[model samples]
Target: MRNTLNQRRSTRQHFRLLEQLLVATILLQLLNKPAVPVLSTLLQILLLAWL
Candidate 1:
């Protein structure tokens, strides 16, 4: 039925969004790792971007 198909489409969209969030979180953690002292770097980048 149309309802079932719509449900499947919504589920798929949720799954994809979750996957993207997970990947982005992992990437952000990697950037913020202590070895990099990345908070300062990030702040500098943000300042430059804001300007």
Candidate 2:
């Protein structure tokens, strides 16, 4: 039981890390482009839904 709990915790940590990386990459890519308020807002909404 303890081992299973540890495995689950580790899995969650991995997922959290991946989520952070994905968000960071998206933000970085968007930052490279000229600012578009509407597009950024839509992207944020989509990203939130994905998470």
Candidate 3:
């Protein structure tokens, strides 16, 4: 139905936003300090949970 399609589109947009956020976080961390795997890992876990 149209509602289901809308939901799917919204979910996809959320995922895209999250992916951009994750990339930005990683880039910021790398620029601000040495590469920290823990933060990135935690973010990944959080994103997975969100999905």
Highest-TM-score candidate = 3
Inter-residue clash pairs, candidate 3: none
Q: In model 3, which runs have C-alpha deviations exceeding 4 angstroms?
A: 33-51
lDDT at 34, model 1: 61
Put down candidate 3 lDDT per residue, 1-51, tens digits, no spaces: 999999999889888978886887778786885555676776788777876
Each candidate structure's TM-score, on Cα atoms with residue i matched to residue i, is: 0.62, 0.61, 0.65
Candidate order by TM-score, highest to lowest? 3, 1, 2
**How many residue pairs in model 1 have overlapping backbones?**
0
Candidate 1: clashing pairs of residues: none
User: Candidate 1 at 48: error in angstroms?
Assistant: 37
Give the clashing residue pairs of candidate 2, or none: none
* 1-51 per-residue lDDT for model 1 (tens digits): 999999889778766765665566567777776634454465456446544
The clash count of every prediction, one per candidate, is 0, 0, 0
Off by over 4 Å in 2: 33-51
Give the Cα-based TM-score of candidate 1 against the true structure. 0.62
Candidates 1 and 2 compared: the better one by lDDT is 2
